[model samples]
Target chain A: MQSRVDATRCLSCRKGYASHAAGTCKECYEESNHKILDLETKVAFLQFSSSLDPSSSPCFSDVVLVASHDATDQTDLAPPVPIHAHKAVLANRSPVFRAMLENQMEEALSGTIKISDVSHDVLRAFVNYLYTAEACLDVKMARDLLEMAEKYQVEHLKAYCEKLIISKLNPGNPLNSFLSCVLASKHKAKNLLDAALSLIVDNMDKFVELEEYEELKKDHPQLVFEIYEAYHAKQVETAALKEKK
Target chain B: MQSRVDATRCLSCRKGYASHAAGTCKECYEESNHKILDLETKVAFLQFSSSLDPSSSPCFSDVVLVASHDATDQTDLAPPVPIHAHKAVLANRSPVFRAMLENQMEEALSGTIKISDVSHDVLRAFVNYLYTAEACLDVKMARDLLEMAEKYQVEHLKAYCEKLIISKLNPGNPLNSFLSCVLASKHKAKNLLDAALSLIVDNMDKFVELEEYEELKKDHPQLVFEIYEAYHAKQVETAALKEKK
Candidate 1:
């Protein structure tokens, strides 16, 4: 009878109810309910958002896959699942990015990305690229991305695209490559002015025309006059050499 | 006689002259001539440039001083003295930059920068700030310069100014305290884009706007959506609390 009583006490202790509770432990129940409530809140938001916005289904699928696949892959600012759930939360949410991504993928598959030919898919891929940035990318794709981003009023995407282009503008790329980059950054995306000009300096000789020179002056007035003087000196020297010859 | 010859040799060595020749050797003559030639070049350029473009006369003077100082100093591509001579050399060849500089400066000092009340001097200062390319600068001057650079077409200057602003966006400077350094970078300069956004994630709520959110969506769709969602969730929670109250 004493042994039976001791066993009963031990069972109650194991159950965490003998010391302070009659049967159910208050702390344990609270913790369990708290977890359930948290899960339910998240699930309800996801379901409500999904039902409200069908256009975000693709993004939602991506989010869901990300959430279920690996809990460790949460480097992005967004939660890894049901991507459209965010759209429901944010006001004036637009599906512009969806188009950007698709366009980028299409352009990648194709050879070049004509600025005029930009579409929704390209925009979506561009958005994805910005979200999940990479260290290395194709130069051609980078250029296309820049042109598209600049056109679409996507400031962040344009900046990213410019950076990639600047990096690829090694000494090996011809001087002509920087002309567009310089113009674009100078006018539309002011942030790339330094990097673009720094690259252009290597090919200063290529800017021959008064028109081209004037354009550079308009963009970077301080640099143009300086370049013109140097060019004139070189011209004079060449003329003298020709006369001697 | 031998001692006399030895003394002559020592004097020749001091003057960078070949000992084989008698008083005032060839090396000394050449060195002296080169120094004179350098001085002459600077003076001629200064005079010609000043007479041709009086507006940039100060720049010319600065260049002459830097060139005449020392070759070693010329090589130092940092703050000490403005390397205006290198710029002068380039300007001598390119007329466009000269015209642009003259026009920009004229516009700035004349107070004709804004469409309504914007001062052109601010714009000119901003362009000059970029042209000078100094790593550090005066705070008040920097803000003024940034505002002007943005006003004019000196986008690169604006970008650099934005970078400087972000770096110094501490709470101490009440006049220019940043609510969100990242948003400031994105809004102020073109190149800052997604890269700047990633750095100031914690402060996104304090500064990001509805228009900016939409803009970010197209370029950095992932960041835009994520930040928007997080921001909205917080708002929702706050609203819920109010309801409870």
Candidate 2:
């Protein structure tokens, strides 16, 4: 018991006095251990949470790191050729592209990353997307990262962007289009099905139509009906508004 | 010109005169003709709009008309059991399904036909959606009514219920799945995507490995990276609530 008391002193102080007292004693040791364990657990929980929740973790630290790293690379030094700038940009100068590059510089300095807020590279990619309606995304990239784009709410840049590539390119390079669709769909990429449909509908001519297709059509009238109805309704609303004027 | 005036006056009377001085006068005749043309234009606009925005139109009235007009002696009394309720009622008792049915009943009795509120059959279909997901939609019906759902902000339901049918179902049949992905993605129906993915993902054995499969197993993550990033981040900050004990 005396030996145990000797071991029970405050870790901060090497003194052995008042071993039974709460603050600097045996009781304190036991209490602090529990407190330390709780602190460690909470720290671990937060660390895990920060990694998962990028926005909450630290203000765009990862974005700054990745962007800075990419910028430092010699390969990214040259002005990226804007793939599909607006017609005005192509005809004159890519103001949007320039503005986007400036924004990237600001973001890099501030150490912030809103995926919706484009970098020069992303803007160039966006232009490329607008013109080509797709981009050659790294097929081998982890899906979780691609999913992150969706999580960050970067509209038109996440999985749907990938869907665009799959649908338009149909690269058929051992990439899974279906999984891409699922991820995009999950992430609220609105045009995913349209993109998929456009791709698959066109492809059905090349491939044999599935039996399930017929059944789905029979059961789901809202599919085509809504399209027809929307087209007509818009026409009617436009006309009504015009007449009211 | 005199006859034209008389014709204009007659039209203004029928169409609700804008001003008393122009009632049935020569100017009124010209105005009435313009009004008729405007009405025609408005109808044309509605037609186009309904086609573009399928969900808003709810073409149920048209479907009902066609089903009734084209009925055969052997036709069933229940309007083919409205495809939506048949599956759920056949499947099991579901509370969401019941709530949807109640909502539909309210819409029908209300008789307002607001773009957001739908009739009983559509509500039943929505309930079916809560159960089976977007997989078994009647393409035309789902597409036509989706706009209504979107307009009214039943966004989650719209994403899950109708768009699933649109993306999964064949668009070639009377029920085209044209609005499938576009609307669903817009409304952020991740489950719908998952449902469609299950139906659509090709040869999963080829792509997903055993370990990867285990990691990707969850329906939703504890710390979702996208929309809730900021919210989750806030969680990290308030984590260490100092307990007195």
- Number of the top candidate by lDDT? 1
Please provide, for model 2 over A1-245, each residue's C-alpha lDDT reduced to its tens digit, 9 standing for 90 to 100: 22555333324333332222313222323444454544333222211111212233231112221223334334755632222112211111223323443454664345343344234454444333322223455543324334545543433345445544454446242123333444555665556545543444344433224434455456544543533454466568879999999
**lDDT for residue A111 in candidate 2, whole number 0-100:** 36
> How do the residues B42-143 of candidate 1 rate in per-residue lDDT, one tens digit apiece?
222222121112244232121221212333434556422222222222232224333433454542234222222333333334333322333355555556
Error of 2 at A142 (Å): 18
- lDDT tens digits, residue span A76-114, model 1: 464333222221111011224334333445532342233
Model 1 scores a TM of 0.23
How badly does each model clash, as a count of residue pairs?
Answer: 41, 72
lDDT for each candidate structure? 0.40, 0.36
Candidate 1 chain A: minimum summed lDDT over ten consecutive residues — where? Answer: A85-94
Which model scores highest in TM-score?
1
